[model samples]
Target: MSRAGLAAERTALAWRRTAVASMITGALFLNHAVINGWRPALIAPIGAAVAMAALAGLSYLRNRSLREGRHSRGGWVVATASATVVAVAVLAFVIEFTDPLP
Candidate 1:
């Protein structure tokens, strides 16, 4: 394969890695919610986990696009990913404030 093809392959692999990471993050968030017991405040972590799942879905779509050579700018994917991260951060802050340690 040419250098350009190799580059695209690398990009696709990167996206796959990102999707895996997002799934792992979502699992961790879910685990936290479960461990903390089923309080209403635990909803924040549950929501965060759902957001992470969405992020993973987006990553998968981007990866598929890259693999298929449909190389438009990924501005939407980047923006959405950024928004998801920010939202997750905010949710984490809320969870921390609402769930006081013993």
Candidate 2:
């Protein structure tokens, strides 16, 4: 394969790793929510998990595009992923600092 092909392969692999990481993070968030019980206060963790799942889905889409050689205008995808991460981080912060409902 050519250099460009190898680079694309590497990028695809990176995306796959990112997807896996996102899934793991989502699982952790879900686990935290479960461990904390079925209180309304656990919604933040649940939302974080959903965001992580969306991130993983986005990563999968990007990876598929790379594999199919349709590498056009990925800026939106990256932007969305960034926003998701920021949102998840905020949710996590809220979850960590807030007192559990009585």
Candidate 3:
């Protein structure tokens, strides 16, 4: 396998890690939202988690294609999703800080 071949595995692993982190961050924001009755704030992390799942699914498909000797799409989408996750994490933190549990 060429070095590019490893992109599939590495990107997949990164997406998995992002998905896990997104899930945890979403849960944290969800808890805060529930506590403070800020239902709209729940959307940020939910969107991030959904994005993470989509990225993971895409990575899985890309990896399969690569294993079959097809040219894989580059990592731009994964990088974008990672950025989205970071943005959501920041939003979650804002929500958490602004509305502590009483």
Candidate 4:
């Protein structure tokens, strides 16, 4: 692969790493929700996990397009994914630290 392709691969790998970390956060949130005996609290983390999976899939597709000499607005995708991950994390924290029933 060319150096440019390698760079793209590296960036994609970084995104994947971030996604994996977010998955861990999701797991923790889900676990905490279960411990707290609140079934609804699982929603936020579950959604985050689903989003992470989608993001990962997009990253793979973006990489494939890159290898195929197709233009991909990966920067936008990465930025959006990162923001989503951050939002999910914030939501999880809010749900975790606040009382939902009272």
Q: Model 4, 1-102: lDDT tens per residue?
A: 788878766765675676566566656655666666756646666676677667666656665665566656667876877787788768767765774553
- Residue range 13-80, candidate 1, lDDT tens digits: 99898899889989999999888788898778998999999999999999999999987889888899
Which segments of candidate 4 are over 4 A away from where they belong?
Answer: 63-71, 99-102
Cα RMSD (Å) per model?
1.6, 2.0, 3.7, 3.5
Cα error of candidate 1 at position 44, Å: 0.6
Error of 4 at 68 (Å): 5.5
Residue 37 in model 4: shift from native, Å? 2.1
Q: Which stretches of candidate 3 lie over 4 Å from their true place?
A: 1-3, 37-71
lDDT per model, in order?
0.89, 0.86, 0.61, 0.66
**Candidate scoring better on TM-score of 2 and 3:** 2
Backbone clashes in candidate 1 total: 0
Candidates ranked, most accurate by lDDT first: 1, 2, 4, 3
Highest lDDT: which candidate? Answer: 1
Which stretches in model 2 have alpha-carbon errors above 4 Å?
99-102
Residue 59 lDDT, candidate 2, scale 0-100: 94
Q: Please provide, for model 2 over 24-58, each residue's C-alpha lDDT reduced to its tens digit, 9 standing for 90 to 100.
A: 99999999988778788777788888989989998
Residue-pair clashes per prediction, in order, are 0, 0, 0, 0
Global lDDT of model 2: 0.86
Q: Least accurate stretch of 10 residues (summed lDDT) in model 4? A: 63-72
